[model samples]
Target: MISIATALLCTLVIRSVVSVRGDEECDASAAYSSSGGKICASERGDGYGSHDVIRGEDRMIPIWWNYDIDQLFEDHFDCGQIIYGYDDGHPDDDHDDDYVDGLDDQAVKEQHIKISDPVSETELEKLRYQWEILREKYVREVNIVPIFHEVKLDSATETTGVDGKGGFVDRPRTHGVSAIVVPTRIGDAGPTKGRGVFATAPITKGALVINLDNGSTGLFKVGHSWREFAVSLPREVACNFIEWSWVQTVPPSSVIDEDIRNGLSIFIAFDESNLMNSADWDDVEANVRCGFPPKHEGDDWGPCRFHYHATRDIAAGEELLLNYGDFEEISQQGWVDIGL
Candidate 1:
């Protein structure tokens, strides 16, 4: 197993993949580029090879976005044969013969996958997360961003205290104690902008909001198929890990061994600190900054600890933002001189 500590030593390099919807490329300079990065379907073709399945007039939605597992599975049943990849070890075998093939309405189901009775909500969420990871990998390999339906804003209005005079707003719920989530105007324009970190109470300048020390469990997992590893874990374990982890689809060139470059890494931050969003360094609203704990004379081997602090005094409801400046440079230089 590649140690997360060793992986961290390899600086991060981020590669930009141009997003195209149909024939034209997404305009990076457009006003809506940063606003959730969505593009419209072109009248010519939607480009997913299944153009016949989806009309040009309809909004392009990723195949995995649907929540109904049975329907979703039926729609992309062929993917199951590819993803599951069941084989009986025949060198010259053509496995496609095992299943009946025809149009969706005409094909007869020949294979069955069993599901547990009374599927729990957590299990369903895990399935969704796993499905998303699989589809994301597929799309990246093909170099296209699947157009997704706009996420619906939370339907419930912000709750208020008994005073009824803009008394209170429900804070973002979390299992840890670093920061709380609050609504902010940082995303696509809709009924709600998006969720961001907020101070549950007053915080003084330079105060630490959260501390991350991943020496114990190395913050990264390097592999070719992280999805298989994730899904193979016990139900609850896989669910929690996937819910909190972020996948770096393309790894830095510093770690660019032929095999490693093709593979990806999964980063896990074992705290709510992972929720902190990015902002520009000069942005007045960028209140949070990441720092490292001071090294003592004898603590030469202490694991890298990431400390997040307030740049200025922050009010109870003010959003916390960090400037995630050139991560590739930071990773390329290694964490020893991370100035952010």
Candidate 2:
């Protein structure tokens, strides 16, 4: 059941009008109206689940794990603040600014920016600054190895194959940011397969498109483990985890650490950063490319995050695509890349 605080949080959340809710039964409002069945169909090509289902269709983003509602409210960490607060940190701070001249701080909370305004630029800047400190405090392993994504089961034959379920990393600390509602995003687009992430503005090169820290309770970046992972989960929840939008498989021939070689399927759960799409090697050559920001100059690096930079210049209304593992390389190696 949704808590009173959670319900209040939703009233302040920001939302993209064109979020990738499919046409049939995937409406976000419907999520609130009904308990889940196998009604909402899947939209990806990765053959894992026959279809995906959202238990609360009204919930804006898919959550792989639950959050502590009481603590979130006690700390004044409203999930709605995530959606309603500063996104890309670009709204004006001046009271004379026409866009938000009249709306008091209390009134500036909505999924759409119509009646709302973001937190002050100072607050947003401070949040970004705090993120820098966290990255330095917890320097762990870089996790994009080619072996962790080892569990692959043939759905048609119902056959499971894995020499051993690979490494499973303990959940990381939460980042400061948890609100998924942002205005810097465009409506969803699908070129070859499922939905992809796009920019609402002309994104500059080396721009930090997204960041995930361990402290943000809404997001969880975990390693896949078949033996101890989601074994007893219901089909809808389990399969959705398997076809993780954030799970990127590093090529086999690419030499890397011995420990991280576990078919690198970094399982992450959250809203925007995790929901972006994957482009093949050539689909976005003239546009944005993904990179891992080194932990310096006030930037943190992690296995799950691959920041997208404009190869040349990405125009507004362009889809932001990350180059995923080469299918041929994974196929040639004869190892199926599974999320969990």
TM of each candidate vs. truth: 0.32, 0.34
Cα lDDT computed for each candidate against the true fold? 0.35, 0.34
Superposed on all Cα atoms, the candidates' RMSDs to the truth, in angstroms, are 20.2, 19.4
Q: In lDDT terms, which candidate is top?
A: 1
Which ranges in model 1 have alpha carbons more than 4 Å from their true place? 1-193, 214-218, 231-266, 281-285, 292-305, 326-340
lDDT of 1 by residue, 195-214 (tens): 24556678877676654332
Quick one: best TM-score, which candidate?
A: 2
What C-alpha lDDT, on a 0 to 100 scale, does residue 34 get in candidate 1? 23
Worst 10 residues of 1 by lDDT: 110-119
Displacement of the residue 16 alpha carbon in candidate 1, Å: 30
Per-residue lDDT value at 323 in model 1 = 63
